[model samples]
Target: MSGTKPPSALSSVKITFLGTASAQPSSTRNHSSLALHLGGDVWLFDCGEATQHRLQKSSVKMGKIQKIFITHTHGDHIFGLLPLLASRLNGSGGTAEGVEDPRLHVSTGENTQPLEIYGPLGTRAYVRNGLMYTHTLLGAPYVVHELRFPTDPLGDFTTLPRNAAELPTGRNIDQIDGHWPDVFADNLVTVSAAPILHSVPCVGYVVNERPVPGKMDPKEYIPAIKRTKTPMSVMSRLQQGEDVELADGTILRGPPRRHGRKIVILGDTYDPSPIAPIAMDADILIHEATNAHLPGIDPTTKEEDTYETVEMKARSHGHSTPQMAGAFAKRIGTKRLFLNHFSARYAGDDDVNAETAEVMNAIGSLAAGEYGGEVTCSRDLMSIDIQLPK
Candidate 1:
């Protein structure tokens, strides 16, 4: 079999919600974990408590998870890391296969690849303690990158560290670019992170696919090369948007490729303003909506929520309300916004569906009505296929 394969359609980015609960897990919603499906590989964000079990129930492939991005050091956001890593180190349980993509099976033994974790400065210590206490061993090698924001009291996270402190050795990861701090990059996509406002140090991530090569008209080239009998291998180069030399010394130029999709996924945050600029015009924005209104406070009542009331209720907790999340989405102008990290109170009495709908309607009514974008609530195991530009 040929090892070389044609480039995939990177335009299609799928997001799978593994766990979407806030600090406490409700009857239905688990702790927060989201999987970004980029072709065959999966990029996970915010593996909260019981996330490994959530992954076990979902279609997300544990073996194919190339990178794990932690928003902060909060237990609700990161308590599940060590166990998940241990599961990966050992293999997918007894013939357990991928639910969505059947081709994705647990590749054990020699098939394992290096798993990388990206998070704030204290992440190294957090993971180290988890491993030490649990006494977990790993078959697949892993690396941790700790991103630190400026410590100056006056300075917010406007300026972020270019490179993270690589774990074990506590050295910095080699910088890929002078201007943009590159966290990870492959032929399919590039991942980058920036600091966002939360009670703790939180990082928001952006994943962008590489440019796709433009289509080549075989009808135009085939007839012209009929007399010369050009090989199919040479034609492959032309299809890849490369300039090809014909037997008659004529150069066949290929068209410029199209740009792929751009997505932004943020962690738990009270303030979304810091991430708004970075998420500007994104194809999709996954932001936390930890506050929907105190239970029994009817989400539709605008009169009840005076500025002081909301600030005193939600802001002090380092969490964003549906209104705050919506306003932020409006300001950022993301094409689509997904409200995640629901506070357990929203799902009062185990009516998660009704509560989620109420929250979505409340947020959608606020942001999408005024901002001209789409707003939807995310639930565990819900998958959204991102529609990209042509």
Candidate 2:
């Protein structure tokens, strides 16, 4: 059990889609809630309506989720936050003894961790409102950290006073670098952000972590666990970041493990130039594609929609069509592209599959045709294990 090394590549993370619906929740598409599976804990990005219900259906450890990262404060995205947090807090504190990773279904035999939430504006008010009502057993009290955009007329994600009236506080948690600049740098990952044309202040996030190379010198732990009978729980802490100590206080220091950085959900934006670093030759880019540019009516001829699609027509209202999302991904030189946050106009309708395929093909073609990247659509509960390019 002594002198054991750990695996490189930060824990394998999976983005589980609880719901990918836009505003309206349907039988097919719920609102937007994607679980970022970081081995033990789950980080939820944008908990749309009924995201908690979706969590029950998926293998995502809802109890492990306390942190949430919301893209914007749209009703569709924030409404579910109340119920999901309440249910997770009230129903289950930890996980059941059964729950394995199908990487999809929650199995019982394996070990899992708790959850946390992070997001942009209104997160504090939003979380506070939810907690105010529910009876949650949050020893950590499901922390909430609000990230505001800075400098521009919009909100500031960085550079704010602790005493500012509008400023929000982190729950139970002590330190957090919500500063958009430090979002990736401190993690040793390069991250960037900028404002987009949303109704209110909406910003996008891009992250790229450094990759781990070769294995290290700690492969001898299997025998140690058997010999010393150190609980896997205690051992995992040692591996993750903490030191292991015996009843008599024998300290086993955990060294830094190697891990590769990844680009995450490139989320909804009326625009996309700000998050290039996250897309910087990213192996994957998950951008929103709520518009598909169907052409029965000529845009030039139609005076109203001279500029079609969600991005163009609904510029400041916060939405993007397939073409704009694709072009943005292409411009960022993202190696892979995923389309999510599609409008209700195309969810579970059999007739729309052909249309969906056509839109997918068109957007993929547009991105590949221009940006020279691979493209695909994001399905609910689909787990995509990102592989770094060779």
Candidate achieving the largest TM-score:
1
Model 2: lowest-lDDT 10 consecutive positions:
160-169
lDDT of each: 0.69, 0.59
Tens-place lDDT per residue, model 1, 245-288, is 88988877766667678888888777756555556777788888
Off by over 4 Å in 2: 1-7, 91-115, 133-140, 151-179, 184-194, 215-259, 296-311, 348-356
Candidate 1 — what's its lDDT? 0.69
Backbone clash pairs in model 2 (N, Cα, C under 3 Å; residues 3+ apart or in different chains), count: 30
The TM-score measured for candidate 2 stands at 0.67
Report the Cα RMSD per candidate: 8.1, 11.1
What are the clash counts of all predictions, listed in order?
0, 30
